[model samples]
Target chain A: MIEIILGKYNYWIYIALMMIGFYAMIAKENLVKKILGMNIFQTGVILLYVSISKVSGGTVPIIWDKGGPYDNPLPHVLMLTAIVVSVSTTAVALALIVRIYKSYGTIEDDQIVVINSHDGDKEIPSEKASTII
Target chain B: MIELLDILLLLFLVICAVAAISMRDLLSSTIVLGSYSLFMAVVWTRLNAVDVAFTEASVGAGITTMLMLAALSRTKRFEFLYRKKGQQEDPNKETNPLLKNWKRKRFSVTKVSGLIVVLLTGAILIYGTMDMPDFGDPNSPSYTHVATMYIERGQPEVNVPNLVTAVLASYRGYDTLGETIVIFTAGIGVILMLRKRKKT
Candidate 1:
């Protein structure tokens, strides 16, 4: 039991980190908070991948005169790409959020739904509707 | 890995993650998120992934925070709680006395259900981790594959000391090109969504 705990503590912590992000994404109503949760979740995955590449006594994957085992470079290269992709996703998601705010005048998911449900009935007055859309 | 430093960093990360999500002010939450990304970069460095650390520092902490702040500037900063219809109409007026009492005690269905779902998923993920190889074990399946070949001959063939660069640019050049295209497409999409049209 001790060996298992010691060996896998990092995995457990990463999982916990991921769950925090997951909770935020699901429970938070604000669109920006959801986006922040998505960012945290992506970072958690990246942390897990990078953690997997560590060789116990290895140094960085740069060739030097000192002969020693080097950490796996594959995961590092992969995560580098993943990080860039995450940034790109954030940019696009934020743009969508901005547009949603412009159209709905609110970024809350529930409020947006309320606005949509009232769309067909034209129950909302013209003055408020003009500001909304 | 430096075990003590690793534990400290992970603890800090968890705190940052919780604080970032729980803060009512969006701007402050974004700043905390930036610090979380910075700490993440430090953790990556401790794990011997320098290239990834650099990318996280620049792209994660720098660019992502800037984008979020820009979005916040365009929108409201504070997250508002769901207001009752009666409350929205008049600040002091109560439509129904019983309804006001019921609203005060009402719980959010979304919050409760979301917590249940998140906990279930987390439990499953923790169960899956039992079969995973121990951290930093050189004999793990990941190192037994092409990683060995890449590390041994990568420097000699590509004449680059950094094996990450050699693999990313030479061994996987097409993959990098595809990623570049993805970023380009994202940039174009953002521009299209945000640009204002001239009045005709």
Candidate 2:
């Protein structure tokens, strides 16, 4: 039990973080809150991947003249790309949110849907109407 | 011990995430989320992931927060109340002013369905982690795979001391180019969406 507690506690903490983000992503009403939850979730996954590359006595992936063990480099390479991709996704999502606010006058998902149906029932712009459908 | 520090940092991360989600004020939530990213970077550093830590600190903590605050400034400032205020609907709208969207009542099955989806995801994640090798086992499959090859061979071939840089910029050069293109496309998409066109 002590070994389990001491050795694998990192995974447990990360999993907890992941679950928290999951709950927030599902339940949060605000679109901005959903984005925050997404950042948390991405960080958790990044942490997990980085943790998988850890070596007990190994140093960083930088090779020195002294021959020794090193932490895994493959996961680092992969996660570097993932971290950048996360930011790009966030940027596009936020841009979409801004556009939604401009057209519908609200960022809430439910309200946007309400307006879309209401707008459809009433007179819809010829081009914008097809785009909505 | 390192374990204790790790525990404290992870605890703080969890607190930040929960607080960010629960805050009704969008700006405050964005700030807390930034701090959460900062904590995540620290934890990555402790795990000896220098490159990952650096990226998370810069992109996650820095750029992500700026973009979120920008979006917050553009959108409705506060959360719209969703729960049915049947009996205790506040008469004075001046006290807690909300945008006009608060009038849209939605109690569809979406919330319950969302709960079910998240619970299933959590269960699958927990089960998946059970078979993963214990923390930092040198004999784990990950350390024995392409990582070893990169450390042993890629360094001398590319003349880069850092195996990560060598593999990322050389061995996986094509993949890096693809990622760059993806980021470029995203920037273009954002600019297209946010720019205001002048009516002549």
> Which numbered prediction scores highest in lDDT against the true structure?
1
What lDDT is reached at residue A110 by model 2?
Answer: 68
Worst 10 residues of 1 chain A by lDDT: A115-124
The lDDT per prediction is: 0.87, 0.81
DockQ leader: 2
Q: Report the C-alpha lDDT of model 1 over B1-200, residue by residue, as the tens digit.
A: 34877888988999999999988789999999999999999999999999999999999999999999999999878875555665553232433332333232135777889899989988998889889889999999998799999988998899999999999999998789988998999999999999999899
Off by over 4 Å in 1: A121-133, B82-106
List candidate 2 stretches off by more than 4 Å: A121-133, B82-108
**Poorest lDDT segment (10 consecutive residues) of candidate 2 chain B:** B90-99
**Candidate 2 on B1-200: residue-level lDDT in tens?**
24778889988998998898888678888889988888888988888888988998899999999999888788766776545666544222312223444464565466677778877877887787778778888889999988888889987899999988998999998878888988998999999988889988
Q: What is the TM-score of each candidate's chain B when compared with the real chain B? A: 0.86, 0.86
Model 2 gets an lDDT of 0.81
